[model samples]
Target: MFSRQIIPAVAAIGCVLCAALSGVAASAQTSETPYWASISVSKVYMRVGPSMNYPIEWVYQREGLPVKVLRVNEGWRYVEDPDGMRGWMAARMLARTRAAIVIGEGAAEIKGEGNASAPLRWRVEPGVVGELGECTDSWCEFSVGGHHGFIEAERLWGDGEP
Candidate 1:
């Protein structure tokens, strides 16, 4: 009779241990905020607060646009765009894929290499969004449309450490 009672207790403890281990694995996959992310869908609404009940503040139609995630609460993320606009968006609307937007007063020249003296591959205007590849301190590999080239790191908002 004592052995039967101990068996149930042991099984209960084993189930709790398994649950705790899985929780740790899930939390490990969660990223810290103030990292870079991009719009994953063609349309996403930025709300005044972290919930759907909050008023819509902005409606973004551009996919792949980079946003700096400043905070995470529940399933929402507080983010800031390249233009310095800040708001809360659903976490599912954003992707972990790296991207960047051209910034500054005029078009930025995309060169064949990371050097200014390298051959020119294209010219991208401010606000153009593209996938970001490997980056050094001064330059990053960028691709948009079907064009791929190296661009000065300073010209992009989503460059540098995440």
Candidate 2:
């Protein structure tokens, strides 16, 4: 009968819609991975596992610190810090903005330009997080609080040129 054919066609359409929606959902989840993101809050806890039930492995106090996202779970992301420390942090605690942190023991010199011999603009201590800008082979322009200048690319934790 026509009714039977109509019922099956409607069921088929419903199935196709479900599949398309599920595919969209999966891609949405996966697209966030393997990207650079920064800490959104002033303090965030890095847990041993993806959930709060896990023990706190570390506490990051610096906002705008950049992290490399390795994977994503339900409302959590596995990230690696500049020190090569890896742990899970809440997904909502991170933002898509680019940032960088100064590494090494000494204060990193910020030059007026990318060239090493350029005029010295200022200095920033290690572990300071700042907004990251364009980077060349060996230097990157960064700004923190009210200061902006270029620093050696090797001293930062964000994306660096080869």
Candidate 3:
């Protein structure tokens, strides 16, 4: 009788463990939408819908350009570019790597340090995209091509948490 009771209890415990493990695996496959992502390809098309049968809304030629992912379905991501243009793109063409674009008018000065008092390193114009680095309350480190410097956090579209 003890052996019979122990067998059922062990089987029940095993079923519960399997259920919990499957739940964890399911959660790991998905992420919260509306996150920041960057274009991973040199050229990718933004479609009007989630599938290729949809009309092409735009063709992005730049890689590493930051976009805001508004939603995800199947293998497509609904994204908004720095220009505020929203469309759907293939999820494979986007990466989770952080990137930022210089926004606002004219040119933004990239300083050697995170403070204004630091020497100027570069003057990046609006629309210039680069990899994003650590950020403080007021400034963030930015890199374009081979140059790296700090710029005001407010000047970048992808600076803070998404």
Candidate 4:
């Protein structure tokens, strides 16, 4: 009689434990973060503390580099730069400028600089985000869409730029 009763009790405890575990798992999944966001302004500064009075330690410049937002506290946020530099800054310096990456490594080729024979184009360093532009195989032009020259597709980020 004791064995029979204990078996059901053990099974009941197992079921309760499984249900508790599942609930915890669900909560964890729902609490994820949108920490990584694209910089939309020409340049935003990451400060040392959390205000303007603080020194500017780094910047997420170039209008489109992706930044990892560590956390938002008070009116400021702690962020990590692409180069792994971390700092805090007031929230007003950020804007809606669109940014993108060169994808792989090295510089992208900028074409049409000279006669079409420059078909090989020229290369631009990666990690720089510029406005998207027209491109052909091995050639693309970029600027901040206007600031710089027509860097090659291999070095830009856009519909075909990348």
Candidate 5:
């Protein structure tokens, strides 16, 4: 009789534990972050702290440079650049534009489609910055310096597909 009573109690505890675990898993999934953005202006200062009184750590001159926004604090945002430099920047200096960095050696072919045989649109060199567009399968539409086409997703470093 004690075993029968204890089994139901144990099963109830297991169910509660499972529910708690699932809740934690859901919270973790929802917390995925460090969203992408780009510099809105031609020049901006990356500060050591979130306020203007803080010392400037770096000065960025590129208007379309991509940065990963780690978090927001009042009027400032903590960001990481393509070179992995982390600093606080004025939130107004960043924009929602999606951009990507060309990786690997040699130039990446900007094709007309996702296939290797697709018409060549442009040749983007490694480290080139480009605006990123829709991605499907293993390719994404990329435009850099007036050249627009599709590039293999593996060669890009921003938005979807790692």
Candidate 6:
């Protein structure tokens, strides 16, 4: 009787220990990783310093600009912009949305369709955001402000197989 009672008690304790260890391991997986995220919250505050009481430096005008998350600690993440500016911003101010850019020395033509020879619907100023879409070797489809079009692959950021 004593031996049988000891076996059941030990098994129950073993089960509790396993459960606790697994819970700790699962929480470790929930931590942050480096990736590009965006600004979803309206009026995301960029800090003059890292804490909440710090003065506002700039208000994010666009809702979705791609940002590289450098480090997350407590309530803030250090980030670097596409243009390579580094600053500390509140984690709540950022969101997981993707955005794109137009690169090169000349203007990007927004066509009515996804062909170079397609009719031009509008012209996007370099560094302006267009609705992102699929692509080929030399071009990626895009849209903006109710217009869908294609621009050269070299003229876009976050495009063509990223």
Predicted structure with the largest TM-score when compared to the true one:
1
Candidate 4 residue lDDT tens string, 48-107? 897888998876555566555676665676766556678885555543233445656765
Q: Put the candidates in TM-score order, highest first.
A: 1, 3, 2, 5, 6, 4
lDDT of 5 by residue, 62-122 (tens): 8888888887776788889878899999988888799988888899999988889999877
Q: Report lDDT per candidate.
A: 0.93, 0.90, 0.92, 0.59, 0.86, 0.71
Per-residue CA lDDT of model 2 for 1-162, tens digit only, reads: 999999999999999999999998777668545889999999999999999999999999988989999998868889999888999999899998889988988999999999899999989999888999999889998999988899998889886621
lDDT of model number 2 = 0.90
- Ordered by lDDT, highest first, the candidates read 1, 3, 2, 5, 6, 4
Instruction: For model 5, state the Cα shift of residue 43 in Å.
Output: 0.4
Q: Tell me how candidate 4 scores on lDDT.
A: 0.59
Error of 3 at 135 (Å): 1.0
lDDT, candidate 5, equals 0.86
Which runs of model 5 end up more than 4 angstroms from their true locations? 1-32
Please give each candidate's TM-score: 0.85, 0.78, 0.82, 0.44, 0.76, 0.61
Model 6 misplaced stretches (Cα beyond 4 Å): 1-34, 48-50, 53-57, 112-115, 160-162
Candidate 3, residues 1-162, lDDT tens digits: the string is 999999999999999999999898666437697799999999999999999999999999999999999887878889999888999999999999999999999999999999999999879999999999999879998999989999999999987877
Per-residue alpha-carbon lDDT of candidate 6 for residues 1-162, written as tens digits (9 for 90 to 100): 999999999999999999999898665434566656666665676776679888877666766666677776666767776577777788777865555677677777877666778888778887786556777777787767777778887887665432
Number of backbone clashes in candidate 5:
0
Where model 1 places Cα greater than 4 Å from the true spot, the runs are 1-30
As a TM-score, model 1 comes out at 0.85
Q: CA lDDT of 124 in candidate 3? A: 95
Q: Give the TM-score of candidate 5.
A: 0.76
Find the 10 residues in a row with the least total lDDT in model 3: 25-34
